[model samples]
Structures are given as structure tokens and as C-alpha cells.
Target: MRIKALALAATSALLLTACSDSPSDTDIQAALQPRLEGASCVTAAMFKSFPVTLGSTFSTGVSSGNAPAFDALTDAGLLAKSDKTYSLTDPGRAAYVEQASGFCYSQGYEIAKIKDISPNTGPMGAAVDKSWIVTVDIRQKPIAAWAKTPAIEKLARNPENLSDVPKTYHVTVGRVKGEQGLKLIDPRFSIMRGVSVSQGY
Candidate 1:
């Protein structure tokens, strides 16, 4: 009788332990997909810093009283929420990388280093206007080849080779007049790079 009781207790404990463990991959996937597809970016101002949240939206200036459009992300498991210190999950990072890759290919450009981008100016009037000052190591060889080819230059120089996002983007060329080495400017990156501009969304 004593042995049977001990066995029963052990079985119950195992069941409870299994229940409390991290969600399965299928569960994580289900939670991540929709949020990634329709992710939105909230400004760091919405929170105290990079990953800190100020209690709730009432304390911050975030619109919609939520973390902008990516609100669904946390529940989806793509975004981890530990008492408001949100961080991207592994799946979330993969999604970001994929999006960045697509944007690079679309613009006839590539991102040699994601960290190289930063805001030339501070945050703008709205929460989303903040942009990064991108330093594009111009693929001169490919561009030069295209220039030599017939009719490519005209198509490349067309005004349509720009984006139409709401935020402002800037670029730091390798060298420009009135500066040395790399020169930063108050330019729009999405337009100059001919890619979709987004704060994060």
C-alpha cells in the first residue's frame, strides 16, 4: 500500500512538471507567425530605454495604449515579456533577419553590418519617425558594371527608385565634400537606398 501511494505521487509530480515546462515548438510557431507577419515598431521613448517599459501605456507616450502594432507579438511567443523588459526570441530574430534580407535584395543593396546604422538626428515629433543613419558600402563594382551596360543607367537613375514611407532616413557616404573619410548627412535612407523604410514595423 505504501509503495502504491509513492508511485501515484511520483506520477502526479511528473505530470505537473511536464505541464509547467516551456511551450512546445508547435506552440511557439503558432504564436510567432501572425505577429511576425504584422509586426509594428514602438519607440524606445515609449519605454524608459531599449528594453524597459514604464509600467503601461498610461505612463508612456505610446499610441493605442499598447506597444504600437507589435502588441500581438508577446502572446505569440516571438517576443518575450518579462515584467515589461521585452526581448526578441530566437524565432523573432530569425524573422527580423529574413525581413532585412528581403529589403536588401529588393533595393539592389546589402547590409554588411546591421550595427553600422544609427540615427543621424534624434527622435522626431512622432514615435515612429526615428530613423537610422545607414552607411552603405556602395557595391561599386556591380554598379559600375551596370553603368557600362546599355540602358541600365537610365533605369537606375529614375526617380521611381525610392520609397514612400512616413519616417525619415539618412545616409553616411564613404566620402563627401566638406568632410573627411565618411561623411554623414541629413538624408533619407529609404529613399537613397531604394528600400522600404521602417523603424521596426
Candidate 2:
């Protein structure tokens, strides 16, 4: 996946500013491991509507639905659902690490760096700013191999097989006023795989 230009510049600036008392590389990596692993958490709305497993089925019209994704996310301490909205918790940051780890192991490579992008308010309260970011780099060859189309395609595909009827992925999982719950999300956006970035990007 491509990093945003402004984000890249800002990230560089932040790293430059933080360079004075940065953690040792080993400690940094250790600190970031869990976040990367839990990056695949899904919203409650996604869990309710999509076919997450071979035979799992969920009702579309109802507000309450149980999902394996949520269970996994909650167990991993990566996701939490209140009302209907689904958001990542502290443990979910390992998503980046999980991606990097998979790439390294599958392609025979090394890790170079890990970048963390946290959640925060942006300039003038305009856009949502990435609170923190950890970037991890690996051996060029391994990264390239892992980034190839086949690997990406495999990761991109949904883990569950839905009915022959096609379904879209959506991120809505909450009330209208705020991050309340699943009802907040509009119905039009209905893609099945909510973990696009975590799964492939």
C-alpha cells in the first residue's frame, strides 16, 4: 500500500524530532509486536453481515450479531464494541507486525523498521491524525517477494465463503451521533473483507 504524501512528510518530521531519545531498536521492535498482531479486528457491523466462516450465518436486519472476528479481536484485546461501533483497542497495533512477519517468513527476508500510526486529532481539528506510527522495513528482496500479486491476492480474498450471491464490505458499526455502535454506519458500503489493510495492504 502507498503511504500518503503529507503523512510521509509528517512522519519524517516526527521521527527527526523524536530521534534524540528514541528507544533502542530491540526495545522498539518488542514494544510494537502486539499491535501488529491484533491489527485484523473487525467492527461489529462487519461481523454481523458477512460470512466469516465456512458455515456461519448472521441476520442482516437485526442490531445484535455475534461474529468470530469480534471474538478473536476481543480475545486478542484488539477490538471493542459499544452500542454498535467497533474500534481497535491497544492490542491491535500488532497488525503491522503480523503483516511484516508473514511477509518475512513466507519470502525468506529480514525486518528493517517498524512504524506505528496512532489515532489523534489533526490540524485545526480537521482530519483525523495518525497519533503514532511505527514503520518496519525488511530485506528488499523478501519484501518485494511478499508484496507480489499472488501473495497480495491471497491475502485480499475473504477467508469465508459467502453464498453465490455477491456481497460488499462496509465499515459502519455504530449510532449516527458519534462512534456509538453499528447503526452509525451507512448501509451502502458493504464490502465483505473489512481488514483490507491488515490482510494485504
Candidate 3:
């Protein structure tokens, strides 16, 4: 009789354990798909900074000296350059994947795949006027336990991305109208990247 009771308790515990695990793919997608609404960008660059941070948007007129770093990113093919104009390109996302992969690798995350692409426009007073949305599928490195650190925790909490329902970044790239190009607008990801932002959209 004692053995049977122990067995019954173990079975119930297993069932409860399975129920409390991470969310399913369907749940994650359902949570993620709705937030994709915004301005349409030609390339992935516009949303690169889609949820424009107040730090980048509102300034005290102090320079952080990262302009040349952005220039280097353009030179490295991460950003699209056409006729002396630069914007975010698919390659830029790839470069960012490589960059993020390095950090995530330590936490057992890897660059897996990018699923859907969403493009949209922003509100009249929104910081980013135009944007591109990306759904990235990231997987954990097998055999490594990813202990969620502060960065991982922060990424998990961004409601624009997954709402802790999914484990990947719902990213965006911001864009702007171009001064000189066959393309009406180029992703504004450079020092000259604020023509659209300045428009108060």
C-alpha cells in the first residue's frame, strides 16, 4: 500500500512538471505576430533601431564618440551604401547576428534563422518614422545550460519582442527618406541618419 501511494504521487508530480514548462511555439508566435505593426521600410535597416531608445532620440548635446564606429559598420557591409548614402541592409542584420552570437554563445544561444519580415510606418510623433521588423529564431547550444543573465533577462522582458512567450528578439530597423537615390528612402542608420527622425514622426 505504501509503495502504491508513492508511485501515484510521483506520477502526479511528473504531470505537473510538464505543464509548467516554457511556452509552446504557437503561443510565442501568437504573442509576437501582433506587435509587428509599424511603418514599412525598404530593407531591414530601418527597424534596426526601430524602438528608438530615448538615449539615441533625446540628447543633451553630448557626443558619445560612436559615430566612427557606425561608419566602420557601413564600411564593413553591415549597412547598405548607394551613391554615397548609407542605410541598413540585410547584411547589416547578418553582421549584428554575428555580433550578438558572440555574446549569446556564452549563454548557450546561437543564431538559428530569421522567419518573417514585417515593414511599417510610425505614428506622427513616433521617434522612428519608418521601420522594418524581423523575427529571428534562436536556439540554445546543445549540451550547455543557458543560465539567464541580466542581458538575457532584459531581452526576455521586451514586450515588443515576445513578452517572455518566445525566446528570440523581435527586432526593428529605423529608416528615413533619401536625398539622392532611385530608392525614395534609405534606412537612416548613420550620422546623417536623422532626417526622418527630425521630421517629428
The TM-scores, one per candidate, come to 0.22, 0.20, 0.22
Which pairs clash (backbone N, Cα, C closer than 3 Å) in model 1? Answer: 31-76, 118-133, 169-188, 169-189
What's the lDDT for residue 193 in model 1?
Answer: 41
Candidate 3 lDDT score relative to the true structure: 0.35
Better of 1 and 2 by TM-score: 1
Estimate the TM-score for candidate 2: 0.20
Model 3 misplaced regions, further than 4 Å: 1-108, 124-129, 142-168, 176-201
Worst 10 residues of 1 by lDDT: 138-147
Number of clashing pairs, model 1? 4
lDDT of 2 by residue, 1-201 (tens): 256888899999998876633434565444433322322222233323222232223334322333433444544444566544445555444332432321121222223444432322233222222122334443211222212323233433453311122222212122123332112122343223222323210
Off by over 4 Å in 2: 1-20, 38-111, 114-135, 138-201
Which candidate would rank higher by lDDT, 1 or 2? 1
Q: How many residue pairs clash in each candidate?
A: 4, 48, 14
lDDT of candidates 1 onward, in order: 0.36, 0.33, 0.35
lDDT of 3 by residue, 15-45 (tens): 7774543233343333334333222111222
Clash number for candidate 2: 48
